[model samples]
Target chain A: GDQVKQSPSALSLQEGTNSALRCNFSIATTTVQWFLQNPRGSLMNLFYLVPGTKENGRLKSTFNSKESYSTLHIRDAQLEDSGTYFCAAEAPQGGRALIFGTGTTVSVSP
Target chain B: EAAVTQSPRNKVAVTGGKVTLSCNQTNNHNNMYWYRQDTGHGLRLIHYSYGAGSTEKGDIPDGYKASRPSQENFSLILELATPSQTSVYFCASGESQSQNTLYFGAGTRLSVL
Candidate 1:
């Protein structure tokens, strides 16, 4: 079974628009991490959360451990934001590794 | 910034041949991990290590073996490559206290035929 699942497998946004990505976890998680895999195939860490919300520039993320879900919001989408967004969950009781979601591919056009 | 470097950006191997993917991190983190990225299955953990000389099987470790000979280096080994194992492999490193925040390498693309 997939412990982590992402919604809206693919998305297209126009420049200056805003969109959100969601992740649902079937397993108990204590923390969550969001990543962006750029066009060059490099995975960059976007945000790390502990059952709360954190904002970084045009990107904001929330992790609700109680409900076993997380969300990432993209504001003022840019061409550089076109990439694959993935959310990973940390279940302390499971192991030291984080469980990852299938990911949402975002394509922001100008 | 944390830096993780993986060797052989791309590799092609024949079935039954041995293949090795290497990763080195400069952050001196205590935890290192190897994962494969497939089309529909974002990323699946293959192996991980807590520190030097320690390796643990991850979610899908049947055809993979990992080695952590030092704090900065981790290696994934495939003794007998198969076509089904063709995928992009990524290596990550993170501190023990914040293992969830991982720093990944560019990734190594492996193709087996």
Candidate 2:
């Protein structure tokens, strides 16, 4: 069984549009982090959240540990945003390794 | 921001050959991790270390081993490579074991023939 599950395995968005990606955790996690893996295969850290919402420019993320879910919203999508989005959670039993979701492949086109 | 670098961006190894992937982080973070990414599996942890001289097995550590000899370096070893071990490997470093942010390396693509 997967401790972390992501929805909408893949998505396509036109430039200037908005979309949301989600991750659901079955385990009791304390925190969550989001990452964007660019086409060049570099994983860039996006946001790290606890139990609230955070906004950074055109990207916003929310984490609800009580409900065991997290959401990443992209506003005004750009071609540069085309990449794979992954969410990882920190669980008590997961040790130093964060449990990761299957990831959402996002393709933004002009 | 932490800077994690992985060596040998691409590698091809014969079956039963030994392969070692290296990682170096300049941030001096206490936690470092090794993970493999596949098409459908996303990113799965193979090993992690809290600091120098401390290595721990991760979720998928069956055919792999790890060594952390110093605070800035970590290595993942495949003693006997197999086709199943073909994947993209990434190294990450963080300041804490929990509630921490991680910085990742560019990733190493390994193909076992």
Candidate 3:
């Protein structure tokens, strides 16, 4: 079974608009991390959460371990924000590795 | 900034050939991991290590092996490459704690013919 599920397989938004990505986990996860795979194919870490909310400039994220879900909110989207967003969760049963979601492909156009 | 570098950004191998992908991290993190990315499957863990001389299998470890001889280096090996194994491989390093953030490499694109 798929332990992690991501929403909105794909999305497109205007440069100045806002959007949110989500992930649902069936496993008992201890932590969650969000990553942005840029146009160059580089996976850049965006946030690491522990059942709380975190904000980084125009990006914000929240994790609810009890509910087994996480969300990433992007504000004032820019052209540079066009990329694939992935969420990974760490669980004791899953070992030291983090289980990842299928990811959401986001396109922020002018 | 944490730096994780992977060697051979791109590779091409024939069927049944051996392939080795190397990763080096300057962060000196205790945990290192290898994952593969396919078109529909975002990322799947293959192998990981907790420290030097300790390697563990992840969700999808069959037909693959991992080596962690030192704190800064980890390698993923494919003894008999297959076309199905062709994908973008990424290496990452993080602190031992689950809450710690992970730093990833640019990834290596491998093509097995």
Off by over 4 Å in 3: none
Error of 3 at B6 (Å): 0.5
Please give the TM-score for the first chain of candidate 3: 0.95
Docking class of 3: medium
Off by over 4 Å in 2: B97-99
Q: Write the per-residue lDDT of candidate 3 for residues B1-113, one digit (tens) a residue.
A: 99999999999999999999999999989999999999888898899998999999888999999999999999999999999999999999989864568899999999999
lDDT of each: 0.92, 0.91, 0.92
lDDT of 2 by residue, A1-110 (tens): 28899988999999999999999999887789999999998999899988999999999999998899999999999999999999999755434568889999999988
Ranking the candidates on DockQ from highest down gives: 3, 2, 1
lDDT of 1 by residue, A6-107 (tens): 988999999999999999999887889999999999999999888889999999999988888899999999999999999998754323688899999999
Model 1 stretches with alpha carbons more than 4 Å out: A92-95
Q: Write down the TM-score of every candidate.
A: 0.97, 0.96, 0.97
lDDT of 1 at B89: 98
- lDDT score, candidate 3, position A1: 22
